[model samples]
Target: MFVIDVIPFARFAPAGALSYRFNEYVLPGTIVSVPLRKKTVPGIVVACTSVRDAKESIKTAPFVLRSGAVTTTGILPKSYRIALTKTATYHLLPMGVILREMIPEAFLTHGFPKKLFAGTGHSLSFCEKTYTLRIEEYKKIISCTKGTVLIVVPTAVEIDRFADTFPSAIVVTGALTQKKRLASLKKIKDADIIITTPKYSFIPIPHLAHIIIERESANSYLTVARSPIDTRIAINALAHERSMQTTIGDYPLRMEIRPKPGSALKSISASPIKIFDVRKKITQAPFKALPEQILSIIKSTHEQHGRSAIFAVRRGYASTVICRDCGTSVRTTDGRPLSLITVAGKRVFRSSNGDTVIDAKALCDKCGSWNLIPIGVGVERIAEAVRNNFPNAPLVLFDTNTIRTPRDARSASTKFDIPGTIIVGTEALIPWLNPSNPISLAVVASADSLLALPFWRTRERLARLAFSLTERAEKVAVVTRRPDDAIFTTLENRLDNAFFKEEDSMRKQLNYPPYGHIVTIRIESSITKIEKDTALVQSMLKPKTGIEIPDRYATQNKVVRTIVYKYIDIQKWSDEAQELSQKIYRLPPNITVRIDPESLW
Candidate 1:
């Protein structure tokens, strides 16, 4: 008999591997079916030792070892396994969790085809430009590369776009039907180029050599659902371990991924960015959501039979409702600001979480004041303004609220494609706009509102948004209350170098990203037990470097407390955090640790 150590693919599985008895010797990376508690679960075999060697250890064990059967005959690639281990360690998660997340459940439950290729070359390149220019470079590389080249994009729409460009390339996406996805997975070995979204980028392909990550700055790469895991980081780790050549292309690449000075590809020509001082507009028309200049531009575009786009940072009619009498803001039960949204033509206040809803006429919870006023413009407000100003214009609302599914996105894109149609939306609409068919005009309705977001990368995100707009429109107009803000100067001057230098300096001063790593530990418990739980985490961590303790707040009938740890060396800090995480995992309170979280909140 052989004693095999298995890491069960369960969310709440223990941190360490469990011992299982097997009749045959199983490879370390092979998938096996093991009895975990009352049910069978798929696990990865981490180690194997003969019964003769582990006889004494098994004899002194607390419980009998369960038998595990090999579910998949082929083992995972050694380099891939190492990459997974590094990912687990860096993210402070169990190997099982990493495995469960990285690989599709179908691949684990049912056997997947064995990998047929081993990457042999290592090179990393960065292109800080739009897809219009990047596509040519990608084509050249794809044509020159002998082995199968994997291109990863952020969305299904992008997959479709790339598939159209490379008609012979195999396309894999979650949008595909089960039968189609399975067929695509089976045919990956024969395809020379595979275009896929980040979700299925790990689909084992034969002769895979080059990895091209388009739109590397896309937020979709960093999943925020259950636990945050930056798939970009995981992909980079995998590439490094497998010695695969990597090319990451994005317009204004993320600060963390930006190439060292003078090494990145030259940026493409940008459209003229006109900044309108919204403060002056507000002084002239106190209630006007759309500035006069933007209205005139829309009129001109419509007259010329050209398409126009209006971008808003928020979705609802108003981003927040503030009580004038007591200076109190209307908020949800969880302390999130409430936005006024028009549902079925009736204005109602809804929380950002989209759960709590109240009539617009409702009094403030804290002040009980009827003197409440809506503050900050949103997409709905912008749409309403456009409708009033240009009553005869064809209008399309493009946002998460409107475009929930792929079908909806297609419909929105089709409507926006019509000449003279005005599409109003949030940042979500940027990716759908095609640069080849540039809009006659594009206006950022409220740049200040987007910049007001409390995040370190707000400026970077705004710059990216600006560039994306410039790429898709002939003329981009930004309406900002703070016209003197450095972001506007950067946009007007097209001085990305100056902007990046300033951004880097600020990040270094604040010890954000590139300069340092932050580990966010979120603890949730009853209002009564939250204080104790927070205290326990602080005491246990005892971080020597910078630490932040934000005030605990109530969310969904539970108190949520956040503890942030900032450190320089990832290798040293990750080890210490991993040990502490295991201890905290045993506690009663629900806790989640996120390393290098995309956002502090």
Candidate 2:
């Protein structure tokens, strides 16, 4: 008999590997089936020992390894394995949780490897080096990079575009089918250049010696949909472990640039962005959602036979529904306020949760009053207003509600291709517009709404959007009640560098990301136990840096929840973060945690 430690697929079962007994030895990284707790489970073999040592350490009954054809899966390289363990420790999660995110359950089945190619055996030297580059220099680096290169983009659209730019490169993305993915993997087996989105950047390519992060500043690179693993950190770890060169390119680069000649990146050309003060308009038309100036601009754009776009902050018909007399918002059975929408010509109220839909005639629960008012504006509202203003113009409502599928999105874009057409959409429209095809006029329906968001990156996100729109349109107009806001200065002066500097300084001073790290913990349970659970978790963490103790609030399912924020020094926290996370992960079943959450909402 032999002793070995195997990491099971259970995400929250425990924090360490399980002991297993096998008559024969398997490599440490091999995938094997083992009998676990009266059930067969797949696990990664982490260690192996002699039979004599196994007999000496026997305490509980050891389970036998299931008889099967064991395949040594390259789910991770040696360096990647170490990085994953470090990530698990840093996030205070079991190795299984992190592994679950890396390897999907479907890929775990069937013992055979699916056309995975072995990367080059070139051993990387250990060194810490960072390079800053201008746009032209960045392009030069991409053009001059020898050996197999991995270019990681933020979106699928960029994947297609980059593949065209580097025709010699093979493309891979999550959007590919299983057959296409396999084909893509085979194509890159020996290719000198590979282009991919963040989803497929981990596929092993033997000659992969360099990595280029295109538009690293975009939030799409951050995997916020599921596990909150930053691809940048994973790529950095891979580069360090394998001795590969790496470069990050963006308008306002995410990393600090070294003081070197020709290091400062050049700004791309953009149309002039004009800021319009809507304070007077708001005073003149208090009841109207959109100002007369905006309506007139839309009408004039239609009259001039010019294509235009109006960007709104929200998606539904109305942002919120409230009781008129009580001044209280109508909410779902849960605590969230309901948003007003129109379906089949009947008014309805939908909660942000997406499932709770109520009739508009429903009385307010708090006051039992029938009189209610819809407040705020959304994409649907803007489309309706545009249609009213220019009845003869070709209008396209391009928000998520109207455009449900890829086909629908494509059809909308095709319709948008018509000249003199008007497209009213949410932020989702930003990715669809190509700079090569300039729109005549681009209008931000409500800049104040975006600036008033609770997020710290509000201005940065708005600035990024504004720059992108201005670059793609003949003219970009921003309507805001507060024209003196810092964002307006950047827009009016066309100052990308000044905005980036001010934003970076604010982040450093406030101890936000890129300077400091934050982990958010959310606990949900019965109202009575929610407070107690929150206290228990707060007690577990050491307040070496910062802790936010927000009050527990009620949500759907009558569940009360509280969010705990833990801040740590970016330089010193890695060593201690694993220990802190381990303690928090051991909490009761009612609680869940997220490291570096993209959005608290």
Q: Write the per-residue lDDT of candidate 2 for residues 24-97, one digit (tens) a residue.
A: 77766567666655666677876788768656456445644443433345444576577666666766666665
Clashes in model 2: which pairs?
A: 92-581, 119-206, 120-206
Clashes of 1: 0
Model 1 regions lying over 4 Å from their true place? 1-21, 24-28, 33-43, 46-72, 106-116, 261-267, 281-285, 543-548, 555-557, 570-589
lDDT of 1 by residue, 1-601 (tens): 8998887777667766888888878777788777776777777887899999999999999989876444544567777788887777777766666776677644564455555556776789987776688898999898898888999999877777888889999888878887887777777777899998887777777688899999988878877555667788788888887788999998877888686521222545878889998565225436889978788888998999999999999998999899989998888767878899988889999988787889999998897889999999999999999899889889999877788888998877888778789999999888888877788898988888888887777887888898778878999999988877777777887754566677778777877778778878787788887778777777767645325566545576687777788876644765765676666556552878887665676
Model 2 RMSD, rounded to 1 decimal? 5.4
Q: Which candidate is the best by lDDT?
A: 1
TM-score of each: 0.90, 0.83
- Which regions of candidate 2 deviate over 4 angstroms? 1-21, 24-75, 103-139, 224-227, 254-268, 281-286, 496-502, 543-557, 598-601
Candidate 1, run of 10 with poorest lDDT: 259-268
